[model samples]
Every structure is written in structure tokens, then in C-alpha cells.
Target: MFILPAALAFYRALRVYPSPVELMMIYQKTVPEPIFKIVIELTNLDVKDRVEGYYNKFPPQSLGVKVETRMVGDISKKALVLTKDVQVGEVIYKEFPIVGALDSDLQPKGLYCTQCLREVEPSMSIKSPESPVYEAVYCSQACQSLAKPQHHNLLFTLERPLPPQIPLDEITPEKLEARRKAHTQFADYLKNQAYGHSAPLLVARFIARQVASEMNKLIPGSSGIPSSQDYAGADDEEYLLADHIERLRYVEITPPQEELKLITAVLDTVLPGLDSLVTEERYSTLLGKMAYNAFGVYYDGARDDKPAPTARPEDIERTRTPMGTSRQIGSAVYTVSSYLAHSCDPNARPSFNAGNSQLHLIANRDLKAGEELTVAYVDVAQRQDESVEECRRRRRMELARGWKFACPCERCEREGTTVGSEDEENIGDESRVEKNMQRFESNEGPL
Candidate 1:
């Protein structure tokens, strides 16, 4: 057998089970005992590491630095208990706060999908009392489970009573109370089956009110109907005014073209500001929105100098409707998103806002607390017993209205490919000669 070097032999001797003390013994045997004793260190890491775990696990008593245990978002030692925007692709163990994150004033009404926070998809939403509203929630059972623990805490805190989200007497989004009151009236009107109550009265009334409102904006004519009435107007008009009400309709009794032009000029200047006031973020190439609305403050201020450009709530009432088609000009105004509410047939829904201030409603039959309310903006005519093709037709109408192109809704995904930039018409026939001929001959259409 070959003889191994003394140093190698010493290291090999304690190869399997090495305690620090054993390593020191090996050093003493190989090196001079005095030198080994002088240099021997309990401070050496390699020797300590080999035996550390064994001592901690098997020994009855141990002396070491105490490691403090603390609750953390992760298994790792470094962690923070604060809210942060999650990076797109980064993975992390994190938590969120759960407290009265939602308004407790309103009664719990509906449900939503926890995953998407939409109401259209069918899903089970936990039904809790509207009062002692502790939790603002998601659309689905899955969302509840996925919510960070703090989100759960918010729910627990909201377990007390609060006030209504929006008061009936207070001004809300455009036509909010008016629409709500009108809906109540319509519901009451529809309650009666006599005289084809469903035919068109509500729509007719809405249109008439819209028209009258516009007429009232003009300078007063002697007899028929005065064109412009100041904010302090007749009892009928004054009765309709909320503290911040602005007109949406008008009738021109004066036929003063100059005055109309002047009013028009003033409006062009004012409206952009009104719209910009609410914009918190950029809208495509446009500037941010009208700042969060201070109700009708701006609208009211503009009217002090000239005829208000906005339609009167009452004037649209004067117009005639197409036969059997009782159409209303006033739009539906939503309050808190009903993603906070769910329904089998939800009366209220989300209406995505548009550039022109017109909004289209969407339906979210399944929603929960804390979800933005969405409505079915798809056409009502197409909504009835309609096939998917019919629904696509309705969406096509919306596209014509200039809505966002890609539809992430569940229905849109099920249908054929949605239109995109590549589907738009070509700018020019750039291909030449043989290339042009080939392009024509090819079965696939040009992008």
C-alpha cells in the first residue's frame, strides 16, 4: 500500500464525522502540539459549520445566538409589511391591507367574479348583509380566497353601519338622480299593463323633457316659450333645478342668430376645460380628463356669462318620437359600479365613458363588492334571445361609436377574431408589377 502524506492522512482521519474538537485533535496529532494549540481557533467557520446543524438538532441543551421568529410575507429573512406596486414579471410573497376599503353606507346588493372583478360572467358571490358592511369584495369565491390577508382585515373592520353611497337628493353623475327617479317612474308605469304601458311613454317623456330644456336656453320671446331663462326661472323650471343643475335641452323662441353664434363661440372655449377638469389620466393623444367633477360647479359658472351649452334636464321633453319607438335622449347615469352588486337580471350596469361624453352601458350579471360596475352596452334589441352573431352586431355598433378596439370580455373571446389594426384598409397599393399581380392572386388578404 502507498503511504499517504501526514497532512492528507490527518484530514482523511476525521472525514466522516468531524466535530470542531475532532478537527483540533487531528491538527494536534499531525502538527507540533504547541503550535496547534497556539493556532487552534473555535472561531474557524469551516469546522464550526460541519458540526453546527448536528448540535442544534440532536443535543439536549445548546448555547447560541437566539434567532427571533417573526411573521413575514415570505419564508426568507428579509421581508416588508407595506403596499407596493407589483412589477409585471417579478415573483414575490406579499400582503395587502384589508380594512374599510369600500364604502359601508350602501346595502350589499349583488355579487361579482373574484378573478376578473366583472359581473357579466356567472359565478357565486358571497352574500352578506349590506349593513355592518365590513368588506369591499371581488366578483367570485376564488377572489376572496386569493385576496391578501389585509384585504380580509378590511372586511372585518367594515362590519359596522354607514351612510348611503349617494343620496337621492344630492347631485351625482349626469342624470343620476333624474334617471333614478325616472326609472322608478318607469317601473311604476310599467307596473300597469293597461294601454300598452311598455310602449314608449317613458322614452317620449324623456325626449320631451330634453327638448323643453333646450328651448328654455334661448332669450325669452314674448308669448309662446321664452328662449332663455336665468338660473332663477319660472316655478316649473326652478322646481327641477338641483343646486348644481345645468340644462341639457333648449327651444329657440327668439331666432336671434347672432346670440346663438355668440353662445356657440363661448361654448367652444368652455367645454374643453370642463372635459379636462375630470381627466386624471391621458386619453390616447388627448390631454387628461375633466378633473374629478366638482358636481355642476363649472357648468353653473359658465352659464353666468352666456347661454349654457349643456342640455337642460327638462327641455328634451318637447320632441316627438318615431312611432312605437319611444326613445329617450337623456343617458343613464351610474353611481358606484355594481360589480359591488350582482344580479340574475341586473337593472344597473357599467357604461364605459366615451370621448363625446356619451357612455354605453354593459351588463355584469355576476359581480361582487369592490368591483367596478359594468353594464351591457350591447344594443337592447340585440340583447333579446339573440344569437352570438346578434351580439357581435351590437358590438359592431359600439365599435362604430369609437370604443376601445380589443374586447377582453368573455363573449368577445368566444367569438371570431375581433377587428384590429391589421384589418384596417391598406393606405396604398405599394406592391408593383409582378408583386402586385402575386398579391392579387394570393388567397390571404393583405394586412
Candidate 2:
């Protein structure tokens, strides 16, 4: 049976320490321990419940998929399995992003709808003239309306950040000017400093969305804006955005201090204490999660004209895309799609057929009912002038560098042994999970 590591760790900590004072010291040593404890307690109501009812609330059957625990060389991991057989080209599920951001270069060009990431004609675009910091153009009034309430007002425009039900201090010209200044500074930073990586912008928008969701709850009969969960067919009220995000694994990242300060200032300016929602540590984790799980948004296959990234190869941000990040027009994070594991020869693929951020997960091949669903996180096809061995090495290296995981899928294994290649002998999966999560998933007792 799966046991939450958070509970196990807390139990062991109590046994080892055996004193309330000692527990306080333990909490001090691990700053996020208290927060994790709360998350686990709130989510994991019992020993049987996993990740605070994540699996229970988002059951696989609801989406034509089931999550199964499998052993990958003694490492217990979750896999999304098909509940029923599916023919090739059939869509298994559709999902929308929690937050999406257009590419930095494209944001200034106003070539796409900022909300849906859809191409917009210059004459037909709806421009946000009130926003002093950012240039946001929507393809339609509906997109503009949704974007403002969702995150645009809080992040870019000088509108009231919270719902009318939430009491606010008397608004003055000086205060409005301050808020405008903060938004401009944050927007400038994104435009100038946050190129190549969309995580900073994505994280900023996500935090704003969370605040919006919370504020809307204070007002009766106000749904604010439809969230990604609504599109995914999940009950939005049953779970907070935090409940979904905290369960996902994150890469280690140290976001620039200035970036955090800028974002905090923007939040704080709109509503005092709003900045507390994103502490430095929390901000880092959020950025890491965005970096690790974001999918590149593209249309009509993808574009070939994305400007060459000036950052070092190691520093350039990569999103999950079989066509490569260069081809994507934007980046987005999805709750369910995040769980689809990687494979060099994947049986499924993500499609944006509507020419927007909504993702349609389609089966790549005829899939059995119990077969695991997989998608290529990186481009895995053999390029012209490249040998099969070369292609394998290239994809493996990309996975290792981008995701910090070595491909151990059947295709990689079969090709590795057949080609007698040993170039990647030193490469191994270096990806990590939160300590408590790792312990729980591994079924290991606490230290």
C-alpha cells in the first residue's frame, strides 16, 4: 500500500525527538517542513489517501485513463495507463493550462492572443491601452475579458486587484501611480531580463491567478474566470491551485532575487500582504515546476523563425515538445498532462488542434487498454545526415540535460544494446523529487 512520506516522516520525527520543543527545532532546520506537513495533513486525510486526495479527486476513469504504480528497477513510479483500448489518432483526453505565456519575442510583436496564444491579425486585435507595463492583444473580447480577471489586471493593468467584496483602502492617485510603476518595472524585467526562459513570467501569472481565484471566493455569485480545472472536468472548488501544483515534481532552481522582489512588489502594490503568497523558497519551487513541466505551444506544426537564443546551451530553457522549443510560440503548464511520462518512442502525443493553448492528448499508435501512455519530451526523430546511433545519442543527451533523466524506455534499451553504444554509460537519471514525496513513493521509512 502507498503511504505518504510526509506522515511517515512526521511520525518518525516525533519518535526520534519525542518532545514538542525538539519538533520545533526540526521544523526550523527544514523551512518547508511545516508547510509540507500542512499540505500532507490537508490532502492526506488517511493512510490510504495519497497526496491529499489528488488521485481520488482526479481519478483516471474520469479521463479515460488510470494511474498505476509500477516498478522501474526498484524505483516505484506512477504511470498513466489507458482504461480502454484506443485506435491511432484518437484523442484520449483534452486539457487546458493553469497559466500560459507567449514567448518573450512574440509578446512585443503582438502577433498572438496573449490569453489563448492564437495568431491575431493586427487590425482585428483587441489592444489593452490601459496596461502601461505590458503589451497584451487579444483576438476577441472574450479572450480579453477572461485574461483581465484571470491575471492580466493584477500583473499588467492598473485595475483593482481583488474582487469588490474584498475591502480595500481608499484609492488615491499616488497609490495608483505606485501600482503602475511596480507593474512597469516587473514588465520591463520580463522583457529585458527573462528572455529564453518563460518560467519567470509563467510563475508570475500563476501566482496572480491563484490570488484571483482566492479573492473571487470571497464574493458570492462570482466565479471570476473559468480555470484550467474547469476545462479538465474537475470540480474547481474541491481543490485549490496549490493542491495541484505542490504534488508535481520540480527541478532545482535559484531564481534571481531581483526577479522575486519585482514580482512581490507588483503583488504587494495591488494588495498589501499579497506578496506573502510567494516567498523566496516558494517562488523557487514554483519556477522550477514551471521549468520542469511546461509544454511549448505551437500551431501548424511549429514555426522555424524563432530567433536564435543568445543564452548558453545549458542556460536556455526547454519545454516539452517533440518539435523542439524553437518551434513553440508560447509555454503553458497543465495539471494532468504533467503526469504523462517521457519516452523516446512514445505511444501518445500532445496536439493543439484548436490553434491555442488547449491540449488534445492523442494516441500515437493502437494502444491496449492497460498500456502506459507516453510522449516524447524532446524531439527524438533521426535528422537527415545523422546516423541512428547519432540520433539516439542526441536525444538521450537532450533528455539528460533538459530533464536530468536518462531514457530507460524499451526503445532506448533495445537500441542501446543493438548498436553496442557505450557513449552514455556515464549518463543516469539525476531527476529528484521532494524529500518527503521521494520517501513516500519509495515506501521507505523515515530516517
Candidate 3:
């Protein structure tokens, strides 16, 4: 890590330096430490420990931490220790960053993952099959392991990302607005603060980053983000089915509901709005028709009584099913229905992030032709035991703001999965089957 001050200066000035591994090419450096260990500590030690702790007290200290090249980032309390032998200027594994706590309703609305700090990839999300219980979300397997304990290893509901690949849509204003409004409702429910859900906030952070990226491109002269910042993520554990069904209650999709204001305004500047935007059918058929497309909207539709859906894997792939949907940036390819088709058996999903943007599109299934699309904007594993009525109520209050009713799907009726029951007042009326079955909060649980 010495010599070549001129090169170092050039690298800093350029603001576009060599790759991590490429940096190693600058020089080959090594250190020999016999019977030594690289220690990584994530303790609550304060500055006092640094200036006057045992290390300082003993001068060189007995630990014998041999001198070598330090890494890019400084060692924080929660730092990773690389063996002295491990190659430098290379990616290292450390526990993921923890953002916030779960929401009152047991959703993963508070937790945040660093990988998702700036960019929230919808494709990174996974749904749980166990039941409804939201937990912390992460960009990789490492993230999940680091966040499990905080969620109490509870098995509510689930949405686990698989190795299988699926398509996704670029984030848009319509998607943002719809997500915002829904998010506002979800937050409102948290007003009671029954149990915190980090899933919502985490998912929002995950999706919002993508939304912001797209907006900047569409608005050219703008921050690329809308008024609403937060998003309504998956539930931590409950499913207020009736509330969601009623929440998705239709009143002739207005500018407010469709988020036509920001959406249309941006579209007017460059392309057309929904009118010019391909229909759900055409969008599904033609993946590359427009420079960008909304493809779908987020409404309170569900299989167990809420207006929302299960957001299965197949549903999401329909909209982004095309082979390249995952990798494209502008006017990429995906299933049109994967974009707009609502869910009861949702195969797709969305997530929120912290930074600026809101909402994202992720696949839930393999998706077949004509398969209705859906994204699970709520948490799963945690809410497994939540009744349909409770899910509906929660959705209406948290995401829909009492604007609609619960989903009346057969699951909600026979199994009492959702909320839209004759006895809206009583949520306990429904039995808990999926609730008891749900297992892990992270993706591994589903697998």
C-alpha cells in the first residue's frame, strides 16, 4: 500500500479507479504472522476502548495484531476480520447491515439491508409458503441469516426468493403513487403500534430505489421521485382480508387512485399515458413496445378476503416473464399481465426501500399464458395466523385507508383465509390453518 503517490492521486482525481481486484495489480504485498488470528468484533465498545483500552494500556498489547494493509472501509464495531492471508482489494463477507425494527403488526417495515440501501431489486424478494409473517429482508443469503434472530424465528407467512430466474418491470410513478397510497394506509394501521414490522420498510427501501432510478430518466429535469417517500410493504403476520377487498373497492380509477397525475405528467412529456401505454393484454404479449410501461397497478386484491393476492412466483413472471426482463433498464421485456394483472394467487411481489424511491416489481412464479399477475406488497411468514378479516382490516387501514372491502375469494370463504366475512366486526371467526403452517421469515425457510 505504498509508493506511487502520483498513481494514487490520479486514481482519486479520476473518481473512477481500478476494480477491487485490479487494485492488487498495483503491487504484491504480504505479511507473515505465526500463530495469529484475524479478529472481527461487533461489540458496543466506545472511543474510550480505542484510546485507553487494554491495547493502549499494554502499548503493543499481547494480542499481537501484526501490521498489514487495511481494507477500504474502516473497522466499525460490527466489523469482519479477514485472515492476514486472505487476498486484499477483494470483496469480503460480513454480516449485513441492520436497518430498523419490525412494525407493530409484525411486518418487516423497519429493517433495512445495505445492499438495498441505494438500490432495491424487486427480483431480490421472496414469498413464504408457510403463512403470513413478515420479517427482515436482505439482498443476499448472508443478509437473511444475520436478521433471523431479531424476528424470533417465528413462522408466520413466507415469500422466499429462489434460484429460478423471473422477469421484472422498471419502477414508474404510477407504481410509486399506487404504492405510496397503499403504504400510507399500512402505516396508518401501525398507528396502533400493535407490533412493528420491518418487512414493510425494508421492502419499501428495496423497491423505492428502483422507482427513483426510473423516474430520473423519465423526468429528465427532476429529482425523479414523487411526493410520497415511504411504501406499504408485506405484513409482518396478519391478513385483514375484508379490509383489503373493500380497500381495493373500485370507484372508477381516478387520477388519485391510478396516480395518473405524476404518471400522466411524465408520460405526456415523452410518451402517452395509459391510453398510449399498452393494455394489460398487449403489454403481456408485447414486452418491448414502449420506452417504459406501468404494466400494472397495486390495489387491495387478495385470495383470502383482502383486495391483495398471494403474489406467487408465477404471477410476477407473467409481467416480467420475457427472458431479458431481469436485466433490461429502459423498455425491457416482461409479461404484460405480470405488470397489471392483479393477484389472488399472486406469483410476483414488490418491496420498499429507505433512500428516496418507492415500490418495485418482482416475480413470484414461472407464469403461464393468461395467468393473472400479482405482487405481494405485504409480509407473509409472520402474518400466517392473521385472519382474513384481520388481514383485510389491516390492509384497509394500513395500505388502503378504509377505502375498500376485503377479498371474497373462495379461500377466504371456505378456509376463512381473508377478511370479507359477514361478521366484519369479529376477526377471530376464521380458523388458522396457513397461519400455523408458515415457517421461516427469510427465503431459506420456504425452500
Best candidate according to TM-score:
2
Angstrom error of the Cα, residue 8, model 3: value is 54
* All candidates: CA RMSD (Å): 31.7, 7.5, 24.7
lDDT of 2: 0.75
Clashes of each: 81, 2, 146
The CA lDDT of each predicted structure is: 0.25, 0.75, 0.26
lDDT of 2 by residue, 1-447 (tens): 223434443432232211224344444465365554653454344333434456656644568886677777766776788888899999988888888999888898988999989999999999999895699999998888888888999988888877776678988999888889999998888888445578999998887776676556545555445654445533264445665675565677888899999999998889875665466877887898898899998879799987787887667788999999989999999888887899999999999998999999999989989898999999999899898878888888777667767678888887774643433452433534333335645552211
Clashes of 1: 81
Cand. 2 TM to true fold: 0.84
For candidate 3, which ten residues in a row score worst on lDDT? Answer: 34-43
Q: C-alpha displacement of 52 in model 3, angstroms?
A: 76
Query: Where does model 2 exceed 4 Å of error?
Result: 1-52, 193-195, 221-224, 228-230, 233-235, 417-437, 440-447
Better of 2 and 3 by TM-score: 2
Q: Which stretches of candidate 3 lie over 4 Å from their true place?
A: 1-345, 351-360, 380-393, 396-405, 417-447
